[model samples]
Target chain A: MTANWAAVLGSCAIAYAIKLSGHLVPHRVLQRPLVRASAALFPVALLSALMAMQTLTTKGAIEVDARIPAMAAAALALRARWPFIAVVAVAAVVAAGVRALGWMS
Target chain B: MTTKPRSVIIRDAISIGIAVGAYAISFGALGTTSGLTVLQTQLLSLLLFSGASQFAVVSIVGAGGNPASAWASSALLGMRNGLYGLRLAPLLGASGWRKPFAAHLTIDESTAMALANDDPADSSHRGARTGFWATGLSVFVFWNTATLLGAVAGSHISDPRVFGLDAAIPAGFAALVAPRLTTSLTRGLALVCAVVAVAVTPSVRPGVPVLIAALIALTTAMKFGEPIPPTTEDVSS
Candidate 1:
């Protein structure tokens, strides 16, 4: 097989393995206090990290761009009790508006 | 918090699906430009199924990086899914033939949706399961469909970024987690982790910052976070 194909298969194998490993953890281990607490907080951290990565960084570098205002707008929408779709739509609109102004590429 | 209605979970899942799926269009366009065949790109979307890792491989290959490097970077980025698995395994509790399918569908959005809708008062896993399956299937269908569209159309399609679709993922994520950030502990930990993630991103590899942030949150919670109350506390307030 070609290198590209090799990479593709290798990636699939590795990704699947990693995912399966988690499900294999014993139920007893999962019930530990530390583990349970960490699991509870994991989503908060991961989501926050994800938001930072998506909004604040570009290809491993920190860059201020349209996504910043877009995130701010999203926060505002959520604060105002806008529905989930509306919050996402507001972010997109703010981002599109920012980019259309030729301010952030 | 009460168990969110099934419709609410579906709504959250579909919104997230649409946002993430919209991003897939760009992924498809990028995949072909990176010299992979349309078929190859679709295979990645279908099988590999993780967004950041797929993007890592495509971009690295597009930059003339060797296969070893591409695999390494993508593998590193995918490790978070394993961490996600650790959390989701107990929550999902899939057994028999369903195990592999559940593992395959494990990703950021599904995990977040599952946990977000989880009823702290109960461990029935009912709502969490709906969130997981609905979000997983919704994103899979939309993402793959959009990938095909972007791949076949190629440069003829306008950039998804131009419409600011890129913001949708982060926005959707923020909305999912917002309701749970009521307590000072959760809020403070989230803020600190976000800062640490941003602080470390430029210095680390693509997915490492998030890992680091998760580690920090986990350790901090273990060290100083209050013990879980036996009964559900009204944390929403």
Candidate 2:
């Protein structure tokens, strides 16, 4: 219980540090091409890492499950430019549907 | 008299705010189902005020990752907000208390709204300023309200698995990241990261693989030499 609180507060602090520290950065420093470019791509990297981690883990191994189809459905929704809420709802349905079909445990 | 363009900005901000806020329900439900208490989920949204990082942390802890790893990975996800703030600071011109308040609200939607409304013709940056504050404050209020509503709803469920929400949470996460995979390079890197993480997960602890997968982003960005403009938030653009 205590660990949960600690992690929550610590993560919030780090997030604020990133925000406030960015404010402290001189404008000229941010204008640098490398800094600007890396900042733009960091989300792609971090989010992609998240995507893989979420998709690949099941039962403590790299296994395909209902999540695969569900995510595929979501990727398609994103491509079609569906809004965020719709994408999530569609993914949930697809995953739940796949499970209902007994496609995977 | 609101000009056409000004009304458009307001309209867009409110629509986007509702869109972003509605998604908080998913986060609340999933965070609760993933082992976080309702208050923990609510606190994550209120304090962190970042959808992706909050969801990621809850997901990480729910998956049994240690607190340190969860916080580290969540930090990496939140780092973009710093860059976002750097881009926004001058436009906001916030100092003292307003500075921290502005910093807290400098999220993807706020940044995107401000950038979208950049008016080269307007010397005062009125459009951008309005966009930032409007979108930021609206999203914040709606998101927090929606989070509480969702958490209350989530708390009523006797067993989260009965609705298959446990799987839905990760699937929802995948959906969130899907739009970012615009290029073949990104898709390939994601695949590689997935493979590596899976290979490592069996032998290591739960949270370690996502941290390891984070390396794939760095290497790919280094090799590619340009980071794509963020597409996750601004779907219309």
lDDT per model, in order?
0.73, 0.74
TM-scores for all candidates: the values are 0.59, 0.90
The residue-by-residue lDDT of candidate 1 on A1-105, one tens digit each, is 287787777777887887787788665654566755665566567667667766777677788889989999999998898866688779889999999999887
lDDT of 1 by residue, B1-237 (tens): 887899988987887788778868767866775667788889888988987677766655553546675666555556556666777777787889999999999887787777777786778878888988899999999999998987786545357578786676578668756865766777887888788888987776655665676677678767965443211121111
DockQ of 1: 0.45
For every candidate structure, what is the RMSD over all alpha carbons to the true structure, in angstroms?
6.9, 2.7
Looking at model 1, the pairs that clash are none
Model 1 misplaced stretches (Cα beyond 4 Å) = A1-15, A18-25, A59-61, A80-86, A102-105, B1-45, B48-99, B102-161, B179-182, B202-206, B225-237
Model 2 per-residue lDDT tens digits across residues B33-120: 7777889888888889987788888877777777898788888788778778887877777788888888888788888888777776
Q: Give the runs in model 2 whose Cα sits over 4 Å from its true position.
A: A28-37, A101-103, B1-7, B229-236
Model 2, residue B12: C-alpha shift (Å): 2.0
